[model samples]
Target: MKETAEAYLGRPVSKAVITVPAYFNDAQRQATKDAGRIAGLDVLRIINEPTAASLSYGMDRKEGLVAVFDLGGGTFDISILEISGGVFEVKATNGDTFLGGEDFDNALLQHLVDEFRKEQGIDLTKDRLALQRLREAAEKAKCELSSTSQTDINIPFITADATGAKHLSFTLTRSKFETLVNPLVERTRQPCKDCLRDAGISAKDITEVILVGGMSRMPKVQEVVQEIFGRQPSKNVNPDECVAMGAAIQGGVLRGDVKDILLLDVTPLSLGIETLGGVFTRLINRNTTIPTKKSQVFSTAADGQTQVGIKVLQGEREMAADNKLLGQFDLVGIPPAPRGMPQIEVTFDIDANGIVHVGAKDKATNKEQAITIQSSGGLSDSDIDRMVREAEQYAGKDKERKALIEARNDADTTMYSVERSLNEHKEKLPSDVVEAVQAAIADLKGSLEKDNLEEIREKISAASRHHSRLARPCLGKRAAAARLLLGGRPEEPRKRSMRRRSRGTYAESNSQVVVRVRCIKLFGPWEGQDHEIGVRHSCCLIAVTGIQSCTAVSIWAGVLH
Candidate 1:
């Protein structure tokens, strides 16, 4: 739900109240904010999982303790809160990091597999695809059980033979299905208690209990909620649409479409870095509404060291290693200082999108670096720009010319090797292989010595790309096999040679050493008009005497070895 909302920002949809899982930590919440910023948006406010449900319920007149139990595909968040004068302040929220409707679906699928295995005596768990189809069916059944009380799910024709033959089937009921997933559903109590305590409320204070995620629609789920809250929960809001609707409403808030509506939110978890005592020095704590900034310093750990490595971490852990490695950097070439003497002021700021922007500077030198954090496998703006520049530079090169040089080199090497291989392995290879390789080499040679550079480029590129295919029966595994066998693979020959063509390499891998001689060569000072040509990249060791007196002048064009 939050992923889609993040996308809606800065596009056709102008605002939104993104609902985060009640258990989302400050870092995760901040990361979501970062995602929003990247989309060029202002996250009006982050709505907690349960509060979003209350807002969408349209319970303006009713007043009672409410338990908003939301179970998602991969997370469970339950919050108990009150509604007074449209103020749906949450009293508390709790959840599991990895428990929800998805778990129940998986469990039910497992149960089906077990039942089938015991009856038919066939263990089908090894079939991934069959398992996936079963999982999907199980989920569908779970959803059906939510409102209808019972539904029969078809688990037909799963296994298949190479000839496309299918082999099996079954069905499941609500009570049996609930029994399979009941343990997972019951795991939400701890967080529920924690959330209520966090909000300074209890089951008695929650004026009206509400249900949120699609999983909440389950009769078994509702029974549990009612038992805990001591009242029946509101089932009015669509389990799937409430969070989205709340987000859209918040979007309306950001656009000023809804006036006099202010949403003040809090940080979700503690944020800080490891300190000397291995303690988390909390820069920001749970429930602190954001678009915030905080700064710190970097200093040398040893005397005279010129660089200090800086690693910015997230999470509420005293040890740096215990936290997430959001990013890494170094303050380079610092003035030499005594151990722990250099000061580098660093700041880690979290914007509304929850993205961290870190900056650092040497207090004495004021040398600095700044960058935004992106999760692994994704590049930051700087890296993206660098990639763009690299691509442009590569595109600027004459690919045609480059391709020609590579192709010609291929032909040259292959011709030399194939000729030698045919002589050495002639006995083992078939006559056709030898003859074909010889013919291909002849054509490549002609192409290389061709007059037109254009034709040469085209043919060379074509030949190099296709060489492996053409040079078959080159059992010797030759790089120059392109010039060896006729354009195809063949069995191993008696022997084959792979000799590199050498007069000069096709590339200038190493630069030639040269001297830069700056000179203003006086051409015709005596020819009525004095003229000088500025020459650079010249040899200076040679001394030259003038032998010029007119229209044409020549200085010693010394050739250096």
Candidate 2:
């Protein structure tokens, strides 16, 4: 089975969805998924056999009831659905988890042995060889009865005791076959009626019904179905090919080809856990949609209890042992305290593909603990790399946003400091000095408020140099006042020495050198509203401070405005 499954999956496939019987165990499910992985196929999803069949039959219909009575060799499932606008919505589903068409053929084989015993007094009840041959004959007749009005089953076989061989043949008419298979067909009648009742509708509401699976090919099965639904079933989709085709459609959806339709599947069973005093705490009910999140809060019942144990189950049973265990958890370090002191909140998140994640938090400390849900949907290395790259791009955007915010804040701070200083020094400073300073601060703050971060930064930077200009005039006035009040001789103002030095072959790293040059320019008379220039050297860097910029005109001490 593994090799066959591998070979089938290895052929050039874009995507695929594997289907298995609903009653399969965990080990069987794992083997099938592993086999698909080994074949290098991108298995998109796994669907239940019966549900897949319904999709294949109802994908084309805009609205109808498709009764998928699947009786395969080893498994039986009956799913009734209502389709509308390309949505295959399930109305109700029921099944004899152990019964199938093979079981029906086996029952007929037993009947044959009973008749042979009464006619000849030769019992072959303990004969595996005889039973195996009878099975083959029953299967052949069951297939033939579907088309012909009547079919005969003839078997020429050897005796089990090696005494002799005998011929056992019987004719089965369609009417008589209905009488024989009435019991098998009757089991579905109540389930269908219950389905209609639970779905809150009558058979009259269903426009057209569909039949899926090979067992529905029987003429007697068709009669019972028509009598039950009060209408003829649809034959637009083939029974045998429906399931695979439906799986293919789902595979296309996973690959993003068929996106207009959505399949909102439900959990197969109730999910809950046993709580204190042996009471069951229900987390999710049956038929609940997948990819959901639910939470439960708990607290310590007694002092010194550092942990709370959680045992999860997936069945309607009240007892934990009676239900199937999905998983368990422990809320560690719950803290030592009085009864009902530490609060522990637990969250359960189940994803669309039937995977679950658990989280716990301590309410007292507000600390969180998260359980990593094991996933079948793990990304490849390249996908991880791409995700990291996208994350880095977002980080860059965040940094840029912060930088812009900081720039505006700095502009605001600078304007605040400058405005306060201008108001306090208005008495000593000139009117133009105070007004110019106030105007610059106003423009800078207004720009910052309007999200003009770059312009704010530049204006603030320009005003930063104006700080010295403001301080120079204010200090000059204070100095003149102090000298006059003290009746003291004023010291000579410092001057900057200017010089031109040529490049040399030698360079000094530690040596200190200072040079001073003095240029004295005396104006003869005022020419063209200009004055002569006078320069002096100083020991430090010198800056020309004024409220207006002065330019040289006709080699005279220029125009100022």
Candidate 3:
């Protein structure tokens, strides 16, 4: 995708702001960053998808509380944000990573399968190909029913039984389709409610609601969003492209193309350390704006302890064992003291990219230990470095392989075009010419089987040469017809014009005189054909004669033809 973008823009793309679901965990976000690094991109920011969509809708410039409801193909997310003075701050975000349009499609697909089974007495779901067709038809009908009252799904010869082939046909109405997928649509409501509750606001506080993603285009989904938010979903932006537009807008800001717009995202989950007695301690709560830090002082669990283990964890669970353990480290070198006497200050810091850093400092001795939590789901630094090295090692071979594939594609295309032309104009050419063109086509086809790029290109050129020969006769006929259309006489050729200017100097002396000559010559059309033209030649010469010797020099000469 990076290469494709570069090809389209005719330049290298190095920096990008990627978007992920707001509910993506630390591991998931880190994995996304790792993917960008592997693709040779400097990932500027990993913004949430809903936030990006809000930006695309120009919510950054508006002053209000807005809800961005995003239901894409495979995931759903609800984000509540407050926009003021060009600063868009996310108040809260909630989502179901598994519920989305795919679920709706599957629900409709199951309905069709059940109906087919009841009528034909054969389970179409048992056949892979039939199931695939049903899935396609189900998705099409779902999209159609969004705009129309009803749609017909007909798959001829969907499957064959021992008796004979069977056809599947069904008409699904919008009401019935809604009935089948209403449960899936309702799953999105609780997330919105949770997001609103986390944001400390009710439905009335939201000034506007923005719908995003392909599934959000459904009328039923829109109705549900309106029912949940007490306002119709905003249609100010395209649901499918708003996320991408928001990303592009953010990229522009990073590139200094935009100004005065601030984007503040919240951490999806809480971050804290384990306290004494296996209890979870919250330093930074979930939905808190990031690039933030909090510190709390605790003491050693045992008497006269010199070291304290800082077990960092994330999640909303009250027990340390229930939450995810991010990383752990020990702050040592503390002066021995009784329990609850030594001051061990534990600080949790979350950066703008949602990466966590945990540190513990012994206030008594000024000793500190900190760890940057690495994502367990992503590659390590050494692994990324090794992969980058391997990519550089094989870069030339990859280019060569791509060139070979392109050469083969070009050869195949030329062969197809030439074969088509030969069949169309076979009567216009002599038998020998036709045969020669066919033989060239055969040679090109045979070269396609070999791995030699130069050989395939040579065959392609040869085939084009033969086809050009065969086309000459047809070209003459077209020319004659054009002449006949122009009152039985060929059209007058366009005139050619040339202009020239020159300047030089001659020196005179008692013993010697020198002359410098610079000439530029331009030629006109060749062989009385206006399209076949010649080129220009320029040369400079110097001649000198003295009392005792004579010298001549040719300084420069160039010819273009």
Candidate 4:
């Protein structure tokens, strides 16, 4: 996939921001990053899937609370976010990693298997190949029912018995399909409720609800979402592509292609250490924004304690044994004191990457020990280093290819912009200038065909020069012609307090006419100041607004009393 992207972009792509399910733990996120590194990409950030969907919907530009309901093939996640001034901050997130459209398919498959077994007096589940076919048919029927009221599922020669070849066939109605998956749909409700409660907001506070992932397309799922949020789900974005689009948007922000938007994701589970009596002590609660730190001081469980053990755990469970143990370390050399006499400060710190660091300090001695909880289920450092070394061996060839692609892209952009400008202002521009720009555009196009980086760059420079020279007196003739047609004689420009404001006056048979013009060039040498053009007599006041280019003017005139 990396090679394919590089081929299509005409460049060597290296950096990326990957999206993962919001419920993924530290180990899962690390595994995803390791996969990217193995693919020769420098993973910049790991964002949540639902958060990325919101970005694709441009929720960052809106101000309000939003709920993202994401139901994919094998997982369901609900996240509540507050968006204000291009900042998307996730307040809470909840999901079932084992629940999704796949479960729905399985439900339908089981129904089919039961029906066939009852009819044929033989359980199709015993046949592996037949069961596989049934599973596929069930999935297809489920998808078909999403758009239609009913669908027919038929697999010829699916199985055989003493009665010769047998065929499996059935018609599944949408209502029946809904019935089969209603239980699975109900599972999503509790998560939404949990997330809303965690965010400290009610359903009424949510301004918009966005549905993402392929499973969100089901009518039953949409109905459930509407019932939960008290409004129709937003259909502005494609359910299947929004997550990927959001990731691309994030990538643009990191590359400086986009600006102003900020994303603040949260840790899915709590981080803490074990305390007295095997109890779990939470320092950082679940759904808390990351890159944060919390500390609490505890006394020794035993008298004359000289050392304390810090067992880092993650979860919502109350017992240390029930939670996931991330790492453990002992902080020794503590002053021997009576129980409850010494203060042991245990601090839990989580960085932006969602990695946790636990530190313990003795208040009396100021002696501290810390441990960084490493990701367990991913490649080791030695494996990553070997993969990186293998990739670097081809760096020279990749560099040359990247240089050529960049040069060609720059040349193409320059040619298009210059040609578009010339075409737009052709009538106002001198014929010679128009012809010169067209020639430069043609040269640039020809150089692109040769794929010569140096030649293409030279052509781009030449085209830019012609494009820059297009700012010469293009609008003066038109302004003068309009003034003459209005039956007024051009008068000498009169100085005004504002350098950009100028007035012209002409005499008609019955009334003295005045014309005022202010031209503010948005770009080039005349960017900051405005130019005044004279106009002939008219018994009206003309106001021009949004003066973007000297070559184009929009005038709104009103009759004077």
Each prediction's RMSD over C-alphas, in Å, is 26.8, 39.6, 19.8, 23.0
| Candidate 2 residue-wise lDDT, 1-561, digit = tens | 334655888754544588866444323444555455544445567666766877776666556665666666666665656677777666555555566677667667667777778755667666545566667777887888788888765543323222323446566776776676678777767766765665567777767666666777877677777887788877877878888788888887887888666665555456665677766677876555566788887776677888877766666677777776655667787668886877777777765544456777888777777653322344444555565566556877867778889987677656654554455445667878777877777777677667656787888887665543455464453443333333434453432432343311212223212322221232322212222222211111112121111111222111110
> What is the per-residue lDDT of model 3 for residues 1-561, given as tens digits with 9 covering 90 to 100?
789889999999998899999888776788888888888888899899999988877644777998999999999999999888888899999999899899999999999999988998888777765687789889899889989999887665466555544667787899999999999999999999989999999999999898889999999999999999988889988999999999998998888998888899999888888888899999999999988999999888888888878888989999999998887888878888888899888888888778787888888788899887877744887888787778779999988899899999878767765765576667778888899999999999999888998998899889877755654555444543333443344443312222331333435433222333333322221111112112111111111111111111111111111
Q: What is the C-alpha lDDT profile of model 1 across 466-526, one tens digit per residue? A: 3332223432234223222323233423222222323111222122122222333322222
Model 1 residue 317 lDDT? 62
TM-score of each: 0.57, 0.58, 0.68, 0.66
lDDT of each model, Cα atoms only?
Answer: 0.59, 0.60, 0.77, 0.77
TM-score of 3: 0.68
Alpha carbon lDDT of residue 100, candidate 3?
88
Candidate number of the best TM-score: 3
lDDT of 4 at 126: 87
| Predicted structure 2: lDDT | 0.60
Ranking by TM-score: 3, 4, 2, 1
The parts of candidate 4 lying over 4 Å away from their true place are: 1-4, 364-366, 375-379, 386-561
Give RMSD (Å) of candidate 3 vs. truth: 19.8
| Model 2 weakest lDDT span, ten residues long | 552-561
Off by over 4 Å in 1: 1-51, 58-67, 79-94, 127-129, 148-151, 160-173, 277-279, 295-307, 332-346, 361-368, 382-561
Model 1: weakest 10-residue lDDT segment is 544-553
